[model samples]
Target: MRTAGGVAGAVLVLAGGLLWDIPGLEPAGERMLGIFLAAIILWASEAIPLVATSMGILLAEVLLISSDGLFDVADDVGAVPAADYLAALASPVVVLFIGGFMIAAGATKFDVGRVLSSAILRPLGGRPRPTLLGVMAVTATLGMFMSNTATTATMFAIMLPAITALEDARSRTAMALAIPVAASVGGMMTPVGTPPNAIAIGILADQGIRVTFLDWVLLSLPVAVLLILVAWAFLAWRYLDTSSPLALDADARLDTSRPAVTFYAIAGLAILGWLTEPLHGLSSSTVSLAAVVALLALRVMDGEDVKRLDWPVLWLVAGGIALGRGVGDTGLDSWLIGAVPWGGIPAALVLLAVAAISWGVSNFVSSTAAANLLVPMSIGISISVANSTAEVAVVMALACSLGMCLPVSTPPNAIAHATGLVPTRDMVRIGLLVGGLGVLLLSVAAPLLWSWLGLT
Candidate 1:
C-alpha cells in the first residue's frame, strides 16, 4: 500500500509537471490540483491524519515554488527539486507557536492554572441565570489567556458547585454545554484566543496587515455580545428554570485556594504585555515568553509543569501554518478564489460563505484542521473581495473555535451531551439554532468592527 501510494504521488507530480501544455493552466495551477487530489485521498482513506495531509501539501509547495522566478525555470520541470519539501514545514510563525505552547505548558503544570482560573472567574454566580452569565464571562476571559479547552475546563470547574446546587440535573447539563460554546465565541476576541487566529495573523503579517490585541477585542465585541445574549436566550428558551431550585442559595463549590497575589500579578503582566506589544515593539510571542519566565522566576510555576503541555497540538498548529503557507506559495488559494468570482460579490456575501463553510466542515472534521484550511482560503478570497484578512479570519476563527454544533464537533460538547441531560435530539435542536445565529452574527459583525476601528 505504501509503495502504491508513493507511486501514485510520483505519477501525479509528473502529470502536474506536464500541465503547462494543457490549455491555459500554469504549473502552479496543476500542482495545486494534484495537491488537492492528494489531500482528498488522505482525508477519505484516513491513511494519515488530516493535518499530516496538510503538511504534505506544504512539503510539495515549498519544493515547487520558484524563487528564481517562474519563467527562469520554464523548461526544466524538475528544477524545483524535492528536498525543499522538508523546509516547507518550517516558518518563523510556527516556531513562535511552539514557544508559546511550551510557556503555556509550564504555567499550567506548575498549578498556576489555579492561579489563572481564580482571577478570571471572579464575581461568582448566585443562581442559574447568573451562573450561566458568569460562566460566559469567565469563558471569554480565560479563553483570551489560554486555549479553548483549558478555558472551558477551568470555567466548568469554577461554575460546577453553583450549577449543581440548582438541584435539577437538566439545568446542570445545559449549563455545561453553554460553557464551551461561550468560550469558543469569546476566544475570537484575541489572536492567542485560538490557533486559527494566530496562524491567520501570521499570514497577514506577511501581507502587511496587523491587528493588535486591543484591536481584536474591539472588533469582535459586537459578535461576542450577540452570541452571549443568544446563548442565554437559547438556554432560557429551552431550559430556563422559571422556579428557583431548592438549594438556590446554597453553594455547591468545593474548597479551593482563594485568589492569589501571584495570579493577579501574572494576569496584570500578561494583559499589559499583550496590550503594549504594538507600542513597545514586542511581538506577542516575546510577550508570552516573558510571562512564562515571570511565572518561573516568581516560583509560581516549575520545570516539571512545563512538560505537561500537549506537544502534538504544537505540531498540529505548525502543520496548520505550513498548510496555509503552502496554499500561498502554490497560488492554490488564489486559483481557488479566482475560479469562484469572489471580487464581484458584496463583501457580506463572501463572509456569509466563509461562516457557512466553517459550519459544515467542522461537523465532520477536526475544528482545528478546518480552521487551518479555511482561514487562509478566506484570506485569499478577501484579496479579490476588497475584504481584509482580519475581517475574514476573525469570523472563521470564531466558528472554528466554537465547534459546539454537535457532539462530534468538540470534546467538551461531547462530554456534556453524553451526560444525558442533553439527548441527541436536544443537542441537535439547540446546537443548530445557536450555530446558525452565531454564524450570522460573525458575518455581519466583522465588517462593522473593521469600520468602527477605522481599519478601512
Candidate 2:
C-alpha cells in the first residue's frame, strides 16, 4: 500500500512539475521524470533519518536543477534580505549557557561528561520532579545564549543527579517527560533560541523590516515566562510529588581543575557583544562563532565536541531558510498568498489555525522541521490577509514558540524523558493542558502585542 501511494504521489508531482516549468528538463518530458523522482525521494525521506532526508534534498537540487539554472534558482529562492537569509545559518545566541557549557567542559576536561554528571547529581540531590522546572529555568536562560538542542544536551550532562535522585519508575517516568518539554518551551525567549524565530525574523528583515535584539527580547520573554509558570503549575498538579525537594550540594561544589570560571567570563563577554550588536556592528552569527572559537582557544573543549554538533539540525535550518528565500525571491510567497487569498479569513481565525498546526505537528516531529515548514506558510497566509510581511513574520515567530504540546515537541522534554521519570500518559495529560494554555496565551498575547506596537 505504501509503495502504491508513493507511485501515485510521484505521478501527481511529475504532472505538476511539468505544468510549472521547473529547471533542467528537455521538451520531451524529462522535467516530469525529475519531478516524479523528487517526489518519491521526499516520500522515502519519511522512512529515513532527517539528516539523510536533508542530504537527499541537497542531492535532489543538484540533480534536478541545470548548471545554468542552479545559480538562477538559488538567486531567486535565496533573496530575502541578505542579513535575514544569513541568520538562518547562524549559531544560536544563548549568552549564559554558552559560557556554562564551556565552564562545564573545562571542569570535566579529563572526563567532562562524567564530571559534569557528578556535579549535577550532587546539586539536584533531592526530589525529582521539581528539577524539571530547574531544567527549564536553566535551558531558557541558556537558550538566551545557544540553541534549544545545545541547551538540552548541555543540561542533560548537568542533570544527572536529578534524574538519578527521583523516586521509582513512576516518578522517574514523570521527570523524563518534563525535561524535554521544558527545553522545548525554553526556546521561546530569544530569536537565536530556535530556528523558526530566526527564520521568520530573517525573512521579514529581507523584506526591509527588522526587529532589534532588544525588540525581540522584549516581545518574546513575556510569553516565555508565562508559559514557564503555567507549565510548572500543570506539572505540580499532575505529578503531586509527596517528597521533599532533591539535594545537590555535594556535586555543585566539585573541585574540578578545568577553567570553568574563565570560560564563563569569555561567554559573558560574547553575549554583551551580541546584545549590543547594533552598536558593535557585529551579527549574531559572527558573535556566536567568535565565542565558540574563544571556547576552543582556552582549551576548554576539544575537537570531538565540535564534530558532535547536530548537523541535521543545522541542515534542516539551512534548507528551510533556503526555501523561504526562494519563495521570497521569486515573489512566489506573494504569488502563493494571492492564490490562497487569506484576506477573507479573519486574523484571529488564521492565528488560531497556525497555532493548531504548529502544536499538533510538534508532538512527534522535530519542532524545528515543523516550525520551518509552518512559519513561512503562515507568513504567506498572513501577508495575504494583512498585506504586511512584518506582522505575519512576527506572529509566525511567536507561533513557532508554541510547540509545547508533547514530550516529542522539544529537546528538553526528550532529555527528561530519557531518565524514565514519568508515564507517557501523564506527559500527554500535562503537556496537553499546559501546551493548550500556551496556545491560548499566544492567541491573546500576540494580537495584543501587535496592537500595542501599532503593527496590526
Candidate 3:
C-alpha cells in the first residue's frame, strides 16, 4: 500500500510538472519541482533506503537539473552547474556535523557520557517521579550541545539498568519514551544541537539574514525549556504513580583517570568556543574540526572511534542541502512565492500556516528534508509579503525540530521505537499533543519576540 502511494505521488508530481505552469516559473523551475516532489514522496514512504534516495537525488540533479543536462536547457533562467550542486556535499554544515559526531564519539569512548549521566541521575533518589524528571533533565541538557541522537543513546544506555530495575512496566516504558522526546526538544535550544537548526540558519544566511549562535539560543531556549517541562508532565501523568519504587544500580562508577579528564577539558573548550562564536569570529565548523583533531591527537579517540562517527546522517543531510541549492538555482523559491497568495493574510497566520505545513510533512519525512523544502519557501514568502524573514525562519526551524510523531520521523525517535517500550499509537498520540502545543507556542511567541529583538 505504501509503495503504491509512493508511485501515485510520483505520478502526481510528473503530471503537475507537465500541466501546472505558473506565470513566473520557467521550464527549469517546473522540472526541479517534479524532482523535488518525487524525492519527498520516496523519502516519506520508504520505498527505498533513505540514504539510497539521497543518492538518487544527486543522480537526478546531475543528469536532469544541471546546466549541461543532456535532456534540457534553461528557458528563462541560468541553469545550475554541476559544481554548484556537488559542493553541498562538503558544505560547512556537513563539517559541523562531522565535528559534532567526533565529539560525541570521544565522549562515548572515554566514558565522559557515562560519567556525566551517572553524576546527574544518581542523585535523583529512588522514587519514580523524581527519577524520571532527573533523567529528562540530564538528557535534555546534553542535547542542547550534542546531537540529540547521541545524547538519547548515551543517556538511555546509562539509564536502562535503572529503568529495568523499576517495579512497574508502565513507569519503565514512560521513562524510556521521555528520553527521545526530551532529546528532540532539547536540540532546539542551540543551532549546532541539530541538523534542522543548522539547515535553517544556512538557508537564511544565503538571503542576507545572519543568525548567530547566541541569536538562535535567545530566540529558541525559552521555547525548548517550556516544552521539556510539558513533556515531563505528560510522561509523568501517563506513566507514574507517587508510590512506585525506583532502585538504581548504585555501583556505577565515574571515570576520573587522566585521559577522561583531558577529554572533558577538550570537550568543554569546544562547547565554550561554540557558545562564543561571535566573539571568536570563527565558524562553528572550524571549532568542531579543532576538537576532532584534539581528540585524535590526545588519543582520547582512536581511528576506530572515527569509524563510529555518524556518516549515514551526514550523507542524508548532504542530500537535503543539495536539494535546497537546486531549488534556489532553478529560481523555484521565487516561483513558489509568486504562486502563493500572501497579500491580505496576517503575518501571524502566515507563520501558523507555514508551521502547520512543515509539521505535517515532517511527521512523514526526514525533518532535515522538511526544513530543506520549507525554510526556503518561508523565506520567499516573507520577502513577497514584506514580512520579517527572521520571524519566518524561526518558525521554520522550530516546526522542523518539533516533529517526532512516527518511528520513521527521526533517528532518535527510531532508536526509541526500536526499544519496544514505545508503541506507534502511543507515540502518535503524545507526539500530536506535544507537536500541537509546540506550534502554538511558536506562533504566539515569535512575533512578539522578534519585534522586541528589533528584527521585524
Model number with the top TM-score: 3
Report the error of model 2 at residue 124, Å.
9.7
Task: Report the lDDT tens digits of candidate 3 across residue range 171-273.
Answer: 8778888898889988888776887787777676666777777778888887888888888888899877668767765455767887778888988898888
- The clash count for each model shown is 2, 33, 0
The Cα error of candidate 3 at residue 193, in Å, is 2.3
Per lDDT, the best of the predicted structures is: 3
Worst 10 residues of 1 by lDDT: 246-255
Please report, in order, the local distance difference test score of every candidate based on alpha carbons: 0.63, 0.56, 0.78
On TM-score, who's better, 1 or 2? 1
Tell me the tens digit of each residue's lDDT in model 2 across 1-456. Answer: 655565566556645654666343332223324432443344343455555544444443343333333233443332223344334444243232233344334433433333434444445545455455655565566565456666567666665565566554454555455555556666666666676776666556555566666566767677778877777666655663647465453334433355666565665676577579779786665666677778788776668866655456566666565445444444445544566647778877777666766777666666666655556565568656673556556665666656555556666666555655655567677677766776666666666775687644
Q: Evaluate model 3: give its TM-score.
A: 0.90
What's model 1's lDDT at 366?
A: 64
TM-score of 1: 0.80
Question: Alpha carbon lDDT of residue 240, candidate 2?
Answer: 37
